[model samples]
Target: MKNLFLFLTLLVLSVGVNAQQNQIQQDSTSREKLDEVLVKAVRVDADSPITHSNVDKEELAKRNLGQDMPILLNYLPSVVTTSDAGAGIGYTGIRVRGTDATRVNVTINGIPYNDPESQGTFWVNLGDFASSTESLQLQRGVGTSTNGSGAFGASLNLLTDAFSKEAFAEISNSFGSFNTRKHTVKISTGLLNDHFEISGRFSKIDSDGYVDRAFTDLKSYFLQGIYKDGNTLIKALTFGNKEYTYQSWFGLTAEQLQQDRRQNPYTYDNETDNYWQDHYQLHWNQRLDNNWSTNIGLNYTKGKGYFEQFKEDESAAGFANLIEDDSDVIVRRWLDNDFYVINMNTTYKKNAVEIISGLSYSVYTGDHYGEVIWGSDLAPNTNIRDRYYEGDATKNDFSVFSKATFKLSEAITGFVDIQGRFVSYKTNGINSDLVSFITDAEFSFFNPKVGLTYQANQNNSFYTSYARANREPNRDDFKNGVTEHEILNDIELGWRHNTNKVALSTNLYYMFYQNQLVLTGGLDDVGSPLRATSGKSYRLGIEADASIQFCNSFSTSTNVAVSSNKNKEFKASIDGALVNLGDTNISFSPDLIIGNALNFFPAENLQLSLLSKYVGEQYMGNVDSEFSKLDSYFVNDLNVNYEIKPKKLFKSIMLSALVNNIFNKEYVSNGYYYTYDDTWSDANAVTTIEGAGYYPQATTNFLVGATLRF
Candidate 1:
């Protein structure tokens, strides 16, 4: 498969090279329009009734030193980010509107990026992806119908760097706290004879994280070839990463945190996670006529990895016929998977009406296995590479959607969307617990959405929308005995006001759910969160954001969100009995989140900005116990950027720096809570004992970088 992909890539490059000899003249306007078509099916226009935010390359570059994408987006409205290593380089996660990453749908150039079985986006697998992105759009709430998993909380879509018209080369290097460093090199062939272009990037990042024994090493690359003529565009791209990170998922307990905040519990020398993933994509866009256009996308992804661990006093039966009843052992858990996807979409725009229709299909296969490499005692029949537990899974997903927009009148616009999705999942074999685990499930869902926009005047616009979404349980959810599908009904109303120096947006949302899968604050063996079905829940909130230019040298951007999240008539199993919790707060849902940025443009070539974030206290479990509460935190950062244009030997020289947690406040951003019934200690009456663990954030850190472009 790898050879086939390589051959196809070479073929596309050859075709582009051969066509470049003809000296074809291209229109920049047409090229821009064609580039937009690649992601139009999964995105919304500014005039649409959806609530969204757009981030471009220029905005991302200021803090693009070495952090992951989630950390760069931390200042966005209603966003919260966490890093397992106490820094922003490895094993990072993001939550929006109090919803976890698994509920966020992600796409790259209209191809699904979330894992099929887990429905989670692993940013570590695509290290330094922000360097290759041209622009990204984040839609809050169930705003639109998209491919792969349903959008329960938000949808994020990214477009890779566009082909350049002139040849260029760039080198970037950065060094920061925690012995962290990054090196990057990029080159572009530009438009050869105005018909072809090629570009590529390579990056390496290393960090000795703030936490003890938490280190990361990453290497990644991106390559693409493009051919354009008239109204037709063809692009072939490939991107991948290899990562090795020390284990840090096991967080610190309260008592241990008090003793030492940076201590690591695991002392084994070889405890680490190693993974590699690669993606291949081909996109073709054509304009059929003046009012018709179409786009086709194909994607193939291959992933394989393993994490090693040392177990103490494992059971003989668990190790598959071990000679001793209790012995120490070292094991490795592996996951190998293959995914293929195809997407097709067509658009028609004429007069006051525009319509878009698309279809997406995907197939995924994975093998899950564990092997016992070394044991304290072994039987004569035991081989060196004997498998202890093994399993395989297959999943198929298909969807069809159609959306339309109509200018009902001079000031009012109407939108409608409909989608049908079908999925089938099957798995078989023994689980790691030495028990049989088999599953075969199928689901068919129909979702619909409608909205209206009213442009009252040149500076004021009002919009309202309602949407429905349904999602199936992921692999870990199934393992935790949760089998029911979840459903959400969402409604949003907003108003936008724009002028020369001020831009403001305010919105109200009410989301009602049936059989919602809420996090239980408990992690599985591999650190994936466990979830359970809540009978009924709702989230009601008001969000406001603004960008104001006070004068020629100063400006400000700010956003705030206040919400009420609850699980109505909640129930839980207490000491050997069921208890009604009665309208408890949902886990991990904070009431208030605020973000602000104050920018100063002292000169045309220099800029300075101060960013701040505040997150309110929230419960880690649905029961709202004092033990599950995470304290509120307020943090600040400072950023500076300076540019110099040279007349000779270079196009530009850029210098950037960032100081995080400037106040040096020690805070914990994420944690887990769990309860277990103790029957053995108290035979007469069972007692439910509660405990919690926390992940601490770095106190103060800095990163500085310089880029030379020619």
Candidate 2:
């Protein structure tokens, strides 16, 4: 015990000393124009729609290289970023207002990016791809009805930079905290006879996380060609790519964590996994008439990746004898799986009313393989079921959507949206011991939403919207002795205000989960979620965000959210009686979250900034017990930049430095099911089997970068 204590003390001291030597730079005082994002709303309106918040090019430039797009979103309020690297750099994640990425709708050029089956966007699939993004927006709540699946938490739309009209070239280099570094090169071919332009960007990022064995190597490229004249425009844009990362999904027990303070932190369901992705899109825009316009887009994404994990001690936890043969070889197997998706969209716009509609279709398949992975007779992998041949399982999805906008009065505006989704699933290599679920179970729903926005003057606007979202069981839900069904309804009221110097927005939301897949308080190895069944849940929350320009030299922005979540009245399987899920917070959902950014400018060609982020308490499960609760914590970041132009060659350049997590706070941002040491003996089932989970947060780090434009 004394030796363990001494080791932890030395570890903390080492981190602190290393952090001090690498304190992030804070040295400049100027601001550059932020990037301008383009979305479906832009094609339908004269300016950015009321539902979106723009993170312009300026904001994107402020972030150090190798930082994932999710981490860059931290400047906004009501948002939190979780990292496997222990410092928001390498493999990171973002959640808005208690909703994780799966609930958030992501679109690229008005096309959906979420997997049709899982409805989750894996940003790690395209590390540093942000280097190609010209602009983007995060539209909270049910934003204006546009094309694609649905916008539950927020709609993220990104616009890739179009071809530059002038011929130019530039290079950027940055290095920082956690042994992170990035190098990028960009070039543009000037317009040909004032009709066509082409541009491309190539970038690479590498990082060794603050924690043990967490490493990231991401590389990507962006290419675009455009032809435009007067009112017609045609363009081809492509961006996406490859990443190699060390696995960090194995969560530690409370004792293991406290005992080995410098161990690897976990943030995902799988460990020791690495993957890749590549996508391509083509689009065309035209002005049909003065007040009427149209945009047609098509997308094709090719995704092929798998995550692997190292099982510690390949023995079953429960019913071990049932899963083994008479010889008692004690067989065990690991999981290696792969999948893919493809999609397309189109839209039309008019003066008083607009119609944006499109169709999307996706097909997915995967294979699980390894040694003799054990399974009890009740769900054994005989017939090579769990170990399906490295091939595809046929699962398909189809969706169609349309939305309309109406101006009822000078002070009032309304929107109506409708959507239909259809799904068909089929698989053969499922575990032979489990039900064959080989049925073509078809599920569809008519999702309709109506919203009213009243302008109570330019300083304030009040709005209300309601929507019902239905999700059919995906292939995963039915793969291993499991099935799920449900309709998730969301109701919201919001306010918006803006002026030359200030902007503010806020919303109140309530969500009802009709049939939730309740966790049965049991977890499988490697943490891919497993659940039994539950009846319902209710989540209520309020989120507010604001931006201000204090004179010409300073600007500040703040975002915050507070929420109350509880399981609805339901009968428990144990007692067969109605009971609350307790005051337990939802897993990974923080109750009170806040973020603020301050930009200071004391002179021309220079800028200095500081950002603060706070995340409140949370519970990892429905019971909300002391063991499942995660305490609250805050983090501060500082940045400085200076602009300079060489006497010859490069005309303009900016040099910047940033220090993230200046205070070095320690907290748990995410958690998962864990098993006790004793459970290891059974290799299957044990009497003291219990629930234990864990997730860790970030640490202090620093970075330096340079930006140049010609």
Candidate 3:
């Protein structure tokens, strides 16, 4: 805490010393263009042959009272979101086009953000990041070559807040249901002397989740310094978060849900997850001339955390050096990791053609271990903080890609993209189960893409694209005795129309897979979803979104997605024998999803919105058993925003309100299923029994907030 205070003091002093310096006059448009060059390699223009969506800061602020990024993006064309705490505060997840988060590539300023081993994006680590974001783009269905592991499902990239041109300060506070509260402070030494700028933000959030004992406490910070000149830009930034959240991944069983949906099975007070992560980034961009530009990015991340658990009557053999059986124990699992990345890209434009090429390299190392904090009975030589199991892992990844777009004729354009990725991973040591686990693997893949866009008229355009992607299995797959890589072939066709007051887009996509790692509807001991290899699978879907303005005071926007996701000749073991389930529905893949938003502007500064969502029933297991089906649900929310520009004390004041699940619907958005052999049912034959668990969502809730700008 002292170090933080000192740092802030130094920043303030620097800003004060430079406040009286003469400012240099420069074109704001040129500075904005240079800032955008940082992410141009990973993003596409509006007319590109890609299916994507854009969300700006203004749109995100409406519901940004206090929620994770996944919850903020829930209304996209093909998106589904869930939370372990039954609210959007802790342990949140997202799936796109019926694919899990592991397959979604996430990048911040062209640098990869997914965990190297798990290939998962944990939004909880960066609490309230939306506050510092300028904009984000979501490209669905292998839209382009990116800097991450692989975009088997989709790719998302975010641009941080652009430097302000003038000095400003802001404070925001909010209170919501479930004892939720958020506080934030932001400041900017905008455009110091017209060549430098300093900006920072501090935020803290707390919530008592809907489920019993599922509480969250989070603190986060973002700071950046920038230097800008005619065609040169340099930036240095750091962001991090510290969080403590109670465990809630143990979903309720059928009987438990029937009795009390909010009940948590574990009663231990200290069963919680605690983690801290910090990231440092540096970027340099330069425009050599009107036709050439380049960007370079470097990043380093440090993370360490642990989850504590209380075990009852554990076997002596399972824990090393335990001398007694049937003894209670409390343990903490720890992970310490460091990640480094370097990205370089260049863009060229001349006449009717444009080209972009980039290369990325990253290295990662992690240590996994467990320590016993307390036990009912300890051996003579045992002591607290002694590790019972330990492991180490290292990974390296490198990739290069080039993409080009050129006009083929007066009304037609052509696009081509190609990439090659190489990876190597190695691990050594004892696993959590007290077993020897060792692995060494290497992979190399080549991906190619092509597309065409036809501009038929002033208000209509059509496009089609085909892309291929290859993905390496995660660390869990290696532990489960699976090693094969997965492949995907995606095809997209779309049409878009735009006018002064109306906009519409429709997309048709088909994705074919080989050796796909499909979800098994089961979770490991630590709550990671389990997956298995399916020989062949496919997803065929159509997505449409539209917006219309009836008048200046009223407008509406709606989106819908219909899909058919299936696994061909799915096989499962039953009664000690393998059985083929022909043409089964893929687990966790809903057939239909719909979202709508109606906005009303009764006055210039007052706005009201009504939002609704509907999701179709989905199967939890590939076998499509009656017991594995999850029911469909429909939910709605209400939002209101009002602004006041005072003439005296402050610049502007904004008030916002949100009412979630207005109808108080009782619904389950996510769950898990598992099966086991029960030999006791019959002495002569084996019997397969199935069981399931559900994570119930929150009922009616409301939040109100106020922001003051000066």
Residues 532-588, candidate 1: write the lDDT tens digits.
888999999999999999999999999999999999999998888999999999998
CA lDDT of every candidate: 0.90, 0.63, 0.90
TM-score of each: 0.95, 0.82, 0.95
lDDT of 2 at 219: 81
RMSD of each: 6.3, 13.8, 8.0
**Residue lDDT tens for model 2, 312-371:** 332332222233333222222322333333333333333344445545555555443333
Question: Tens-digit lDDT track for model 3 on 378-422?
Answer: 777888888889999999998877788889999999999877788
Error (Å) of candidate 1 at residue 201 is 0.6
Ranking by lDDT: 3, 1, 2
User: Which of candidates 2 and 3 reaches a greater lDDT?
Assistant: 3
TM-score of 1: 0.95
Residue 320 lDDT (model 3): 90
Q: Where does the lowest 10-residue lDDT sum fall in candidate 3?
A: 20-29
